[model samples]
Target: MSLLDASMNAIHLGFAGLWVGSVVFLTVAVLPLARDGAFDAAPLETVTSRLQWISRISALALFASGGHLAGTRYTVDSLTGSAPGYLVLTMLALWFLLALLVELGSKRLVGGFADRKVRQPAREARPYFLAASLVGVLLFLDAGLLSVPTAIPF
Candidate 1:
C-alpha cells in the first residue's frame, strides 16, 4: 500500500544520503580548514556555491517526492500520531529557511562580499557558513533517526 515502495524508497534514500553527506563533509571537515584560512575567498566561495546548489536541488527532489508519497498514503490522523514525523517536518522547515538565507548570501551579493571595500563581508561569511553546517547536521540526524519503522507490537 505504501506508494514509496522499494524503488521509491531506494531513490529517496540515495537522495537523502547525498544531501546529508554533503552537509557532514562541510561541517566536520571543510569548516575547520576555512577557519584556518587554508584557502582564499574566491576559491572557497566557488566551492560553497556549487555544493549548495547541488544540495538544494537534491532537497527539492526529495521533498517533492516525499510530499507526494505522504499525500497518497497518510491521513492527518496518521501523520499526527507520531513524534518522529512531526519532528522531521519541523526540522525540515528550519533547514529550508536556513537554506534560503544561504542562497541569498551566495547569489545576491555574496553576502555583500562582492563589495570588497567593506570590512565585514568576510566576517559575514563565517556565521552563515556555520549556521548552514549546524542546521544540516541537526536535520540530517533527525530525519535518519525518525524515518525508520519502530513500532513496538505488544
Candidate 2:
C-alpha cells in the first residue's frame, strides 16, 4: 500500500477500535455500575453522559474517516472500489445503520433519562449498544480484510 492507503488504514482502524471500546465499556462497566445501585441518580447520569460523549465522538470519527475513505473510492456508478465488493458495500451499510439506530435509540434513552415514563428498561440499553457495536466491528473487520489488492479468479 502507498502512504495514503496506510494512513487511511490507520484512521479507519483507530476509529473502529475506539468505537468498539466505547460500546464495550458502556455495556460491561457503565451500565452495571449504574444499575447495581452503587451510585445515586446523579452518578448514573454522569456515567451515561460520559459514555454518550465518548460514543458520539468515536462514531463521528469513524463516520468522517469512513466517509473520506468511501469518497475516494466513489465512482459515477458505485460507492466502493474494494474487491469482494459486496462485502465492502455491506460494511459501509452498517455505518448508516448505526447512525440511524443511535439517533432513534439515543433519543429514546435521553427521553427516558429525562422522564422515567419513556425510559426503556435498564437491561435493554446494553444489548442495544452491543448489537450496534457488533455490527460496526464486523464491518471494520471486513474492510481490513477485503482492502487487500489481490484479485483471485473464481
Candidate 3:
C-alpha cells in the first residue's frame, strides 16, 4: 500500500476502534452506574455530550477514510459482486445503525439529564446503547473478516 493509503487505513481503523470502545464503555460501565443513581445528572450529561462528540467525529473520519479507500481499491462492479465488497457494504450499514442508535440514546440521556432524571433516562437509553454496542462488535468482526485474504473469494 502507498503511504497515503496506509495513513488513511490507520485513521479509519483508529476511529472505528475508538468509537466502538466508547459505545461499549457507555453500555457496560457508565449506563449501569447512571441507572443505579451512582452518577448525578451533571456528570451524566457531560458524559453523554462527550460521547456524542466522539460519535460524530468518528463517523466523519471513518466516512472520509473509508471513502478514499473504496474509491482507490474498488469499482462498482467489484463492490456489488464480491465477498469483501459485501463485507464493506455490511460495515457501511452497521456504521449507519450504530450512529443512529448512539444519537437516539444520547438524546434520551441528555433530555433526562436536563430534568435531573438520571436513573430514568439511563433506563430508557439502555436498550439503544446495548444495540449500538452489538452493532459495534459486528462492525469490528466484519472488519476483521475483510483483513483475511482467503476470506474474500474474489
Kindly report which residue stretches of model 3 are placed more than 4 angstroms away from their true locations once superposed. 152-154
TM-score, prediction 1: 0.68
The sequence of per-residue lDDT tens digits that candidate 1 reaches over residues 1-154 is: 4555655666766876776676556556765665565656676667677767877887787777667666665677767776655764665586576566566444532554354322244344556656766776676666656666574221
lDDT of 2 by residue, 63-92 (tens): 776666766766534544435555557776
Per-candidate local distance difference test:
0.61, 0.61, 0.93
Ten-residue stretch with the least lDDT total in model 3: 145-154
TM-score of every model?
A: 0.68, 0.68, 0.97
Q: After superposition, how far is residue 102 of candidate 3 from its true place, in Å?
A: 0.2
Write down the RMSD of all candidates, one decimal each: 4.1, 3.9, 1.2
Model 2, runs deviating above 4 Å: 1-4, 73-83, 112-121, 147-154
Top candidate on TM-score is 3
lDDT of residue 87 for candidate 2: 58
| Top lDDT prediction, candidate number | 3
Cα lDDT for residue 58, candidate 2: 66
